[model samples]
Target: MSLPLYPEPVMEGPHGPPAADGPVNILLVDDRPDKLLALQAILADLGEHLVLAHSGTEALRCLLKQEFALILLDVSMPILDGFETAALIRQRQQSARTPIIFVSAVSDSETHVSRGYSLGAVDYILTPIVPEVLRAKVMFFVDLFKKTQQLKRQAEERAQLFREQAARAEAEASERRAAFLAEVSQALMTPLEVEEILAMVANLTVPQLADVCLVDRVTDVGTIRLVAWRGSPAGPVPLPELIADLDPIPLDSDFLVAKAFRTGKVQLLGEVPRFLDEISPRCDTGERCNRLVRLGTRSAILVPVVRGQAVEAVLTFAVVKAARVYVPADIGLAESLARSVVMAWERACLYQAAQEARREAEAANRAKDRFIAMLSHELRTPLTPILFSASTLAADPTLPEIIRDDLQIISRNAELEARLIDDLLDITRITQGKLNLSSTLTDAHRLVLSALDVCADGVQRKNLVLTVDLRADSHMLNADEARLQQVFWNLLKNAIKFTPTGGEIQVRSFNPDARRICIQVADSGTGITAEMLPRIFEPFERGQETSSEGLGLGLAISRPIVEMHSGVISAQSAGIGRGATFTVELPVVSIPMETGAAGPSSGEGGDSDAHRLRQPRILVVDDHADTLNVMQRLLQRLGYAVSTADGVESAMSLATGEAFDLVISDLGLQDGTGHELIQRLQWSGKRIPSIAVSGYGMKEDIAQSDQAGFAAHLTKPVSSQLLKATIERLLALQ
Candidate 1:
């Protein structure tokens, strides 16, 4: 009624089975203990599990506890004998498939053996069983049981090993995904220019994602450029062999790159060598297709790098070293990388454009400086004769009243024009920090009155009400008197020019504080707007209401002049249509009295016949005949012996034959330059005093003239007073 107890399953270890471990059970059933003992003794050396049962009921219980190799039963049991027990064992599903061997003393009859056999007994042993035969038969069953159990254990170990391998593989794949994304992020972090970025990206992708990679970009000229190319170590083909090296992909072409760019999509080509004609139908020679085949290219993908809606570049990858089929994952990675490259390229383009713009602005500034210098030289040339002739006529007592008045008008206007030209030249010099200033103790109030005198005509012409208030007690300031007067005149004239008819102009100067002098010029004229107020002092900047006649350099030049004197100039206005006020403040400092007497304004020389006899010989060279004649007459009037030449050759010829005391040569001759004329004169073994007179009067021009051994450099239209002064000084030094 109860099952036999059994120990836990005995497992085979790596070394050997433990002492208590054994094979599957072999159940021996009998009513007598001696018979069961005798059976166990026969199979004891088999090292198998032997579950003993003295009755058929016990044997059925043993079958419930453990699987058996075989069962030995006796038909001579009192109740539940071998045949009945075997039949009962068969009825139980767990032991139904188990082998059963029946042992009996009275089962020699055919009917009895048939009954036992019918109950699923594999064998029936009679009385007086042979020991050797029984042991051998039981050993065979024991060996079979051991092998079956061993097979089950081996199968379990294999299943566990497979699970571990699958887990390890999954972990490796996750790491690779992380590493791939990290590498791409690093590449984007340290960006080179577009060219270097493209090349680095191509190299990074090769031998990992693809056997070959090519990155192409669209140039500014609507052409494709091969930005970068790379191939795996095993497939060492030249990059030019790839279609990326071909001419720009035409928009109308059927080539893979063209198709991808045109549609702005990814294109996949399988069996690339064979399908080349299908994709690129215009391949007349098949040379490209054949080459790809030889290189083992089986597949490729052309991906367009799209930024917004426009395709900016293309990325091409091929499996050349080995045959491979690409999947969607590969295309996705390439697309991501292309986007990064596009961003880098756009940034690089902006950087390059900014650099180019900066260069252009610098070039424009340099040209502006040069133009100002040239303008100064040309405008000064013709004004010289007018000033000199006006001075000469004014000095003559026999001149008529009308003629003298006309001569005074010419002289005043020429001097005014010269001042305007000098303003322009000063602007250039100020911006370049080359303007030279000579500071002297000057009367500030007197300078303002002088500036007012200069602006009186313009004020009266406009019929404007002008008022002046000079309230400053300490008016003396150590400054360049000429330059300071120029500044004051510019401010006064600007007020007169801007004021309308009958409008009021006020000029006020006072000491705002003990250490500062403030000069304010206010005009009831077109006032500055808020928009134009900030940039009003900038060169060439003008208000909307002003005319474009003058170069708008008045306030631009005035501000620098004040600042150079340790002063500040500012403007205040209510708005347009209201009056505007400009104020200049200069730092007040103690003035030091000059110790030496001032030099004479002009050198002493007589125009008498006796003085003419000793006058120095002067040689004047110019390419213009009219200019040469005027210069000759002007020099002769100044009591100098003058010789004129129209060009460098004549000048050189004249100098060779004559013993001139001074050589005044014009630069830029028709035949050659004035430098050549001077060089020829110097080569003649004479230390002749020379002056460079020309339309080139830039600082660099002056420096070059000094280097060329000239005693002085003068711009054209030189005033007779200045020319005579320079000649007298040079002759005196000589």
Candidate 2:
């Protein structure tokens, strides 16, 4: 006979009822086909999968392929009996828990029945099987199996849902942590006062991270002080009134804040009352602790703000609402917030220090400017007389050529001394970034020649060979003439000083492009070393030639002057003995259509015949006796009726008594300044044309003189011809 095949079971749909466990398989074993057929018919009323096996071995094979709710076994079989098959089925894990019932025909003895039951059988029946009992037993086991599968599925679903909820909660916590740190970082980055920073720190931690916040700072006297605190606005009492009675306490007490500071670590208390009592017995009676308990304090954290090895302050946070509690993770966050506060405090201190330093530096700079002005005035006063007398005597025709030449030398040296003083002032202006340029359309070639002329004495003294090349077609520039000449003079002077006797010096000018002009001053002198070449333009830097003649400010001053005119200056040298070349590049401009007429030439005294014809009465005032005497002789020789005074009072007396055509007054007078004298004379209705002659030649000084009603302001060490021309112009203007 052929065994029947069974179809695979269908799974229940997702929306099926809870009790709908679908179908289950049942296995039946009998050696006789008739008995198997009988059992299948008996269980046909119950709707479930029924698998039929002919022999015990066939039954075990059916158990291997599918799970069954119940197994029906016949005791009498061919090769493997019902008891042996049942033992083997129980040995296999899948069929071990399956309910088994034995069906027997002739094994009616008590011993045989006991043997059938010992083989893991649930029931034993005789040859004429009871159909109703068998059907009821199979249905009972099928229902139990379906219910067990349903419980297993429901448990798995619940576990998965719990995992999803945990993952979402953790992600939200991480997002909140990131946002809080970002807020703290932004708030602490700006410059603020120390107390304000502490207060900000305390205010930032409330409601979100804690219900209350307090900050304690370590004082310089080894004590703790309550610097800043904040309480929740939702608390029972008003925030201001709640903390009104709070005060700083000594660190000797064993409070959490003090303990955190002493150990330089965080102190945490999950159970506030118990831990408080353990740490300090007096905490139970302390007002602060009593207040915290009244507010329903649940947990607290104290983090120390440590800078290096020292504790600078302590931060306290408490959960007073009882809904939240502090955890280990919160300790890390508290420490981070504390660190931000410490960094902000340090930045504020540094900012304050920087402000103080800037003020001190500005004051020092002002003092330096004043000292330079005064020193310039004092140094220039003496040279005025020397320059005046030398120029006067040198102009006399009766003197021998040698004597006249000697006077010229004295005058030239005095002028040289004056230029040195100007350099000192120029360097100071350059460093302060206040150097102003008076730009005009000028010929670079002319300024180069003038600079060469200024250095002619030194060149001739050394008997050096000089070479000049002016090949540039475009050499005109809008620049400061005097300052440009000063740059060229510095380069040539350095070349002259470093070069030995009979050395060669070459100066060249050429157009590098249609828009730019280049000038090179090369000398066969003691060349600069490679090491010093980089810093050659630094202030007070000199070559290693052992020459101590200058202050080493020439190159330093030259670089900036050239740059100010939209130009570049550089130096190149082959080696120590190979000579050096300095090159300057400047932007050229188109020459103007017309050049203004040149002013009256310096060093040419006024027309004596015209002055003698007018006999202009002039009053000269100076505090220096030699300066006054020189002015008197110089003016007298120019054919003017000159009167001299050594002070402002004498000058005023002379001015008021005589009808003067012009007044010349020194700025630094015994009784008053030239500015005062000029103002006084004008106030007294003496409308005489005045010239202010002073050693203070700064731009401010000249401006002050102009404001005082002086027609002109002249720096001291003025040449005789310049003074003479100035007086003639003023008198002519009157």
Candidate 3:
């Protein structure tokens, strides 16, 4: 329908019903007959009955008989004017709240309008009212009065609805909580059995969360047994007599769990305590002494377990132990949560038990795997030397060439095996930064050259093009010579192994401005991708589709060696399909410092590099047949009475009983280390110089040799030149 101009909901006529009618009655008071008639016509058409009285007293009489919807009065009336009539109407108990409007010839100034309304009129209307305006105004009041009535009804309805929603939510929460409680009750009601609850709690929970977890079960004697635990012992502790033999223990404070058990009401311990009552105890001593009352609990929640409407257990969370206190809503939530746990304990006993078994089995499997790995590593360490030495000798070009290339290769392999074993032992030590370093001063350049010499065979076998360009500078440096050499050789060998046959490899060296020399080893083969770049230096990290053909440990071992030398090594590459470069920057200076080398170069250290011999007598001794034969031949070739002995007794017999200028003896023999023999011979006043040779050069071995009057100590893999100089130096003292 097209809307009517000034459309309004119509009201019923006056005298419409009994003493209390559905529609309100209105009285119109106006001295002007036309104005009164106009208002009367409008009210009639509006569907509201109009009661018109020319004077104020007449209106009062009509109002006394029945309640009116409103009053439309002329403010300029001759007697008992609109404002005055409104006052009289308000004086009546029934019409006090009755709305009234003043129809006036006077202009509506703010003061006049205010005063007219203040005298008890609800509104003011200007004279010569249009028919639509009159109908609209009267209809508006009639509609508002109806709305006010309707609002009161709706408000009551809404209040009832809110109460219903709240009650329903509370009932649902209670039912779930009851289910949980019933489960807990049923669980405990059964005969006390040693169930797998401990493992269940650990696996189904703990570790993933919870800093502290403990289980408490009370005995009739009132002792609380701490049956199980999942986290640190510092977690919430249970009381021995927790509400023991008592109905509801008095919690004195607002502790959420305590209140739940004490008052049987759910409480949420939150980021902040609600008011004065719900906080927990604060200790002034012991490890938990730091709790601040104002700051609230370190833990966010404390939920009580109720069984048979009796407090049975408690669960606590430390969200605030690391952060903030839980809130009341949070406390309410925890109360519900605790209720669920209690019910679960009461209901799902079998599931919890099965979960516990699974956890135990998994733990056993992990332990088994660890044992196997440890066993494999330990077994491999010793077998490496035996296997490598046997293979090298059997593959010899000449069976009679003892102390030749094959023998040197065997020595080199044995040392490599020793180093691998040492690294394995020190794995944990290295991560903890507690690995010790036995440092010395030596030439960085020479260290590189020595390592290259050992690895050259592998490079040649690969048939990769390799070049070394060492800078012209002081090769002297203060470092761990053995460690730095390992670093260089590892990188160099890795380059050779990864690069394809006939692939070019370049080694560059320069005084990186004077303080350090940058030695970069670059290869031309499959390059490392950006994805694999970061983890290449980590121990035991073999790349996916690896190009190198050795143990994954080479680069890992190299990093530590370079760091120990007070230098840096870095690996870089463009991407896959391009080659990689490993750069080693080592510190250097002119003079080498004091080191533990007793001998010199075989063909490595420069002339006058301590091993530059001018003919010297020497003694070679060992219990092992192959080792002795090889050493004797190697020394003879260097032109040195390389006497042989099977044991320290014979070696000493030759030393003190003969005219030997220098002595070299194995620390181990058919007897024990030759420490006692060396001591006895020295005490006999035979001042013969000596050097110690051994397969094992552990810390104790070095110390014992030093104390027993050995002029120097050289581990096995003893080079020909180093052996010569050791003898020369000791004989020169004579």
Candidate 4:
């Protein structure tokens, strides 16, 4: 057979080649067209594509175009026979593994079959081919092709799925890191003790970031000490000896914790064995290495807790007995936790400092209150005698007019000095919010009139034109009578002090509404300037022209007292020299069904002849000799039999032996307090009604006297009329 000089065109479909799952091609090669036709008919039952190649050259072309499951080649061909074609097909890279079967008529020639097998043929068939055998052999290769294609597709799908899962895991890890830092920051916002903050940091680090955690704090002396430590519950328990050894490891040494603290940088050991090998030889002994090995430390990270320019502490985290290893991201997380601990420590320190400062301020305030009380006592003790002597001498009708007038001035001035002292104490009470009030169903009109009577002398001295208008229909109020009198007196006194001679002073009261009553004191003298109106009620504040007169506390004390009674006090001025108007507005209450009898008026000597019938015997006690002597003589002049004592012992002896209707005692005594004297007397079966006459007139002092069984608490430098009225009332109750 002569071979063709050139190759023939191979047959193919319009769309290049069939898909992997589509029908596989089977090549049929022969020198004769009839032989190719016969071979095609025999393989037709296999239900797969069979391509026909007239010569070995055409068959080689077919292999180049598309893949095939098997090739059936005729042995004796004209050019490029089956053996030669198969050899060439095997040489090509794409079809090197394609299966081949040779068909020949020379069945007995072993040389021809041996040559075909040597060229990589699977089978040698004689001509007169069995159709079933041919079909069965072709079907086997077709099935194998389909299974191989299925495996390739499955592998590609699995690779794509793996990529997606890796992306999701990275995203989740980033989210977890952010959430952990946020949780640590929120917990550190509140004030926590330094040790507690360290413990919290260690506890929060385990299982999430590390298997073991250790926190070291720098002490006041600048030595780093491990303050808190924690380990995961699932981790192996460390030996007690190892923990003790770990704590004493000097953090300023060459260890990782010390290095991080000294440099204020993070230290990470990804492989503990490698780090151990590097450091084991430098150590004096194997003790440190043994501890690290026993801890099962696989990886570790150490970060410094830095504040300002200094490292305050160091945080250590370790992964033990686990496959996990510490990475760079863990170093960042450790540093974040360290910062939170530093902030918490700072806040706790500030809170402790603030608490200490508050305690010191309270102590100083208490000391100031004590000093004021003592000064008031000393000043009032001497004035008691002066006030008693002048009032007694001024009351004598036979005294010359000039002498009586001089004694009246001394009395008025002594009273004025006492009021100034009371103002000092009242301002203290106001600032402390401890002012106490004794409330009753009081008529505001009565208090205004009484205040007017007290200021009558000052009004006369100034020769000011005074107009009184009381027109309030609902003037009754459930209020503190004495405090209201003080408020009214302060306004009227201020008006008398500021008004020049012949200036008009008008006092008026009227109901602005049924629920409230307004009392206004208007002056036409040196009026307040517009600039001074807002701060007129602040303590120690005074008009520029009137700053030389008093302590400037009258209006300051009045506003709070009025507000305490559910009222408001205000001032208005048309400018200096025109006049100022001070108005007080107070809530009013309706009259009750029945009215109780009014208590005896203060400073009233209430019919001495009527008191002389009973001849009430009173015991007066005081540490001041002058005050004691004046009080005894004053009581005698008021028709009461009085005995005196200088201290608690003498007062007790006098009260127990004598038959007294009232026992009046000063709160401060040389031997003991008047509170002790009254209690001792009552314990001795005396049971006499007593009154507290004290220079210590703070509300606490008065409460102490009342609790000690005193019938009344009368502040020192008491008037004879007030003393007489108090004695008569107590004796009458007896």
Candidate 5:
């Protein structure tokens, strides 16, 4: 077998900086200057810094001042021999690793050679040394030191460049974030309209945050809507032309946008495969993918716009101009932008909803007011004549005793019917916040007694046992006395109505503390169930015990009245079949002693100033003939000259012909509204004092009446006494 030919080994110099500039140092230590001069002349071709020391002590002093690439010394010396000097040189930090060569005259002895090597000598040359060998060894170490310094310099330069690039990148990233947030904020301030906002977002982010952007939203019907899109700036056509052929991706589909929406997570694709067929097996989707690839889309991120736990939309970012990869920090910023978009969309939706609701509420209220007014007119028109005829018949003294008794019954039932109607109207006023309290310092105990007296007939009819304990002596409260009496009456009436025959109903009034007076009504009645206890005070909350026929508004009305007086009312019961206790607490206060007649009770008759005044002319306007006739007779009986009209046209005719001191008109007349009639009267230069009567007595209705120049507002089923008082008051004002 033939041996394979191999190239000769190359002899390379030690790697280092070029010797033409700063040369490396080599030390020569010898007692004889002639030998040093000889050694220097032979090694001068090496081009290195040569250092000389005459003795071992001189060599030690040289090593202390500077470093050397290599050290040369003669072994024989007078004081401080080469071995001791070399050992001391090794002890110093700067010259510890320097290479040393020893010269000797004697032939090589194993002991001498071993001792020189043991003293950290690199080489032991005999006398009559070859200069070529000396020069070659010295040059090798010098090259290594120079090469290390060069490498260190290159590393430092590279590090400075890297730091500069990093600082520039950080500054650019900060600027981009600031610009993005500022543009988005400006877009939000434009208008809350969703379409415009989405368009602004899509266009604003393109070529800045992304090369291309698309925004898609999911509709209420589970259908997707493409809000906005921006193609790459490199495209031959504009952004609209690029997106014109595209369609909304359905949420149930397997597209990346839909995936982000359904999963409510971020989807980042660093490299979208060039082949469309790999993305989808379907031919149609493959074609769409081909178009996107042609648009130069190489990378993408689909971030979901999350509102609460649900994903509302998806924001798509594509890099078309350059292939890019998103880092964790980039993804975090993308999600933050998605949050801003979600907030804008939600705020727009809420604003639209609030506007719609406001419009609907206003329309519904107008219709409700109209309905209540019409219904009141229809019901009260017939009741007016019934009440007036009964009153008129009962006042006739010449009638038979039996007939008089029957007439009395008719009058009583008619009055009772009117009272129920008034209760309904009161509930409407209280619920609509139209009722105002005329608060005064009054006796709570007297009001409680008065409420009991009103409920006396019902208690007797039911044969229910009643007990009274009025222990709150002179308990005066700053409250609406009439409203308080209504509260007391409601609780007592409920007890009488629900209690079985021979059942006990106890009414107790006492001061729980110095600041509060409490009234307790305990009854052995059909108790409220556990389920009903929580909602017992709610309006029309008649529980499963449905034996009652009345509208369940008594407790509902009582609660707000008590609350208006800074008081509280509560009910307690064990369960069904157990008795129930109702407690009402009102604040107690001091009042000055009085020696005169107390004020008349609410909804009661009183001496009027109208009786002292000359007979005043009055006009009654209503569409219902029965109402007109009844009102005319009642007012005439009160010694007023009264005129009646059936409609606005007729009323205007009568008003223009007659000089009336006061005008009382139904709000909803068949011809026109009372507001129109009053406006017409005012326009005609008439300043007659007017009162508005209607069942649509909400707060807004009263405000409208006041705005129309009506002096007072009264709901239908007005009492004869209340009407008389109102008429007298208006006449006095005139």
Candidate 6:
């Protein structure tokens, strides 16, 4: 806590000053002039400038006007005693600490003598003083005082020299900075590569120009790319080449860079821009606003580099190093340097652009790579549960009844995996313009009912009271009804998920106008916060909630899909915990019923599941005992005589030894995907319908299954109805 104040002092044997060389100032105080005269002659051996006083009051008056290093006083005096008089001499601030010695005829006891010492007296003398001892003590303190004064004077002199040196250094620093900047201006027009220029600027620009140097440029896609930066890497990472290749941001946008280039004027930002597009992360404007600015990047200026009447680029400098507002000097040099860099860039535009393009592409490719990696990781999360269940079942058919429960989990997760895969595929299709819509004139109400039916199981699981309000006289719409069903189902499914248990969800539909029908799904769930509401539709962006179980691509995909069908889906919420409403408006037209004509109908009974029965000879192979028993029970219940086996060897032996119409085998067996069984059956020249069943439903897994000659691809815990139907459908087709 304490800084060094002085060097440590060393001690040496005392050496007194020569008395005959000069007279030193000495103080003499007594109640009587006779006593002063008596004390003065006693110390005459030591030369002294005697300051004499007849009383304590006169002595104080004498000490105040002059500096005295020594004082000799009587032990007894009037008004203030000798002890008090000596203390008074020391109390004068200037002479308060002057060494004082007591000289008296009284034989004082220890207590009385101690009182004299306590009053700042250095020595006590008897009535008749011993001249040698008195002179030695006075002379010793005198020489020490003079030596102290000499050292004090020297310290002051050195401190004065230091001040002068510091002032000169500061003045020189200013001149050198000015000269450096002037020299840089001369070097500016030199044709140096960007790296060399950046390195030079990054290293030297601080005192002359900016504390932070950042290059913001337009990307090829017309999005602004933060590029090549020096100082504060905490802001968005910049990709320089991408910025170089980008098209200038739109003039209408709220980016300061755009404003600077548009008017060929420098636009200084003191606060975040007010436009929603500039502030919203969902805007896709790709411009940074307040968040970065708040983190020490306030008071930025965007200076345009103009040539002729066109603005080719913009350079921005913001205060980032300190909290103080930037002064004109801070950005003055940066603006000058920007002009030179712009000149070099423009002259080399034709040659440098191709290289810049490759760089921009590489940067964007990296962004896409990051996006894909996140997507793959998210998609794989569900696959882990499914993959494990299938492999566990295949490896040991002797599993407990719990395997049946795990199977259901696998099927649900598989469905979720399918949806995520669909989203990824949609991304590719969107970029390539390969999206296809299957349109038909279908009952709009029918689709809503179907969505509800698909989501009914999930709704019940959450214990929600699901209600559908349909205006039932049927309106038809020219739409991709199946896809619309999916969109509605996803929304309803999400509502059910976020809704607390025992909450209510209402699905309502009505013709709002001649051109559109409004279908709404309202849920009593934790409503989206104000911040998250706008961006809920951005692909793979999980807003606000850290605990949300989703890839965040659902609404993003759903929104576009709905729009693709010439409909719009929009959401509304007050705030978190207040619930939310989603409405889809699809175009519909009223159609008149045709006058009765007989319709062809010659099917079996209405109450029969018989229309869907193929009665295929089924075999279910899994390692788990519970799965084998459960599948055996489930398959028999579906009216198919079924056989079950666990492990690759058992499955292969059964597969080769007996004929099967359908083989439902787990992909991960004791050894591997039921490939062994497939190989055995093929070797015997007995080809049977096969369904590769497993919990792993990743894109790679589905592809692998297809490559391995699977007839139907299924993930475990597939609903009993789906399992029966898939098998029956395959047999019916055969």
Q: Candidate 6 on 1-734: residue-level lDDT in tens?
A: 01111112222323333224346688777777777777788777666777787777777777778777777777677778787777666666787677887777777557657988898777877766677777788889788777666565556655555556555554565566566656665565454465455444444554344445555555666665555555442245443432344444565576666666568777665533334334577655434343234334545666766667866556665555444344444345456666666665665464478779989987986576556634654454345335444544544557776876676566666767666665675664455454567798887788888888878778878899988888734467888876777788778888988899999999888877677788898998988888887887887765356585777766777787788878898889998888899998877757865569787656533324453454557888876566666677667765777988887777777776777778888766766557667766777787888887665544555667787778877754454556767887676555
Please list the Cα RMSD from the true structure of every candidate, rounded to 1 decimal place.
13.5, 9.9, 18.6, 12.3, 13.9, 27.4
How would you encode candidate 2's per-residue C-alpha lDDT over 367-417 as one tens digit per residue?
888889889989999999999999889879999999988998899889888
lDDT of 5: 0.77
- Comparison by TM-score, 2 against 6, better one: 2
Ranking by TM-score: 4, 2, 5, 1, 3, 6
Reference-based lDDT, residue 714, model 2: 86
Clash pairs, model 4 backbone:
3-79
Q: What ranking emerges by lDDT with the best candidate at the front?
A: 2, 4, 5, 1, 6, 3
lDDT of each: 0.75, 0.82, 0.61, 0.81, 0.77, 0.66
> For candidate 4, lDDT tens digit of each residue in 1-734?
01111122233222223235677798888889898899888877777899999898999888889889888989888867778888999899888878888999985759988998898888888878898887787788778776666665665555545555555555666667778778777877763577777778877777667777877766766566777888742335553445775545565566666677789998888888888887778875434544346667788888888888888778877777466677775666676677777778788788778878988988988898999999999988888899999988888899999999899899988999999999999999999888988899988999999999999999999899999999988888889999999999999999998888999999999998889999999999677777889889999887655455688999999999999999999999988788899999999997743457788788465555455577788888887888888778788887778888899888777766678888888988999998898888878888889999888889888889889999999887788789877887887665
Flag regions of model 4 displaced more than 4 Å.
1-167, 203-212, 219-223, 231-251, 271-274, 284-286, 289-296, 320-323, 436-441, 590-619, 639-643, 649-662, 676-689, 732-734
Error of 1 at 385 (Å): 1.9
- In model 5, the Cα lDDT at residue 70 comes to 85
Candidate 5, 1-734: lDDT as tens digits: 01101111223323333334487778888898998998889778988888989999988888888878788888888888888888888898778778888887767557667888998888888879788887777777677667665676555555555555566566666666766776787677665787877787787776666888888888877766777887564568776776666666567976777778889989887666644546666556565444356566676778998888988778887777764544455677688788777778788889889989999997987676567656655665566667666666666788888997787667656666655665676677776676789898888888999999988878987898899998885489898998999999989988887788889999998888888889999999888898898898888775445667567878888999999999999999888778799999988987755679878777443334433556788888887777778878888888889888878899899888878888888888888989888899999999989998765555567889999999998766666767877887776565
Models 1 onward score TM values of 0.55, 0.71, 0.40, 0.71, 0.60, 0.39
Please give the distance, in angstroms, between residue 219's alpha carbon in candidate 5 and its true position after superposition.
19
- Ten contiguous residues minimizing lDDT sum, candidate 2: 1-10
Q: Is candidate 1 or 4 superior in lDDT?
A: 4
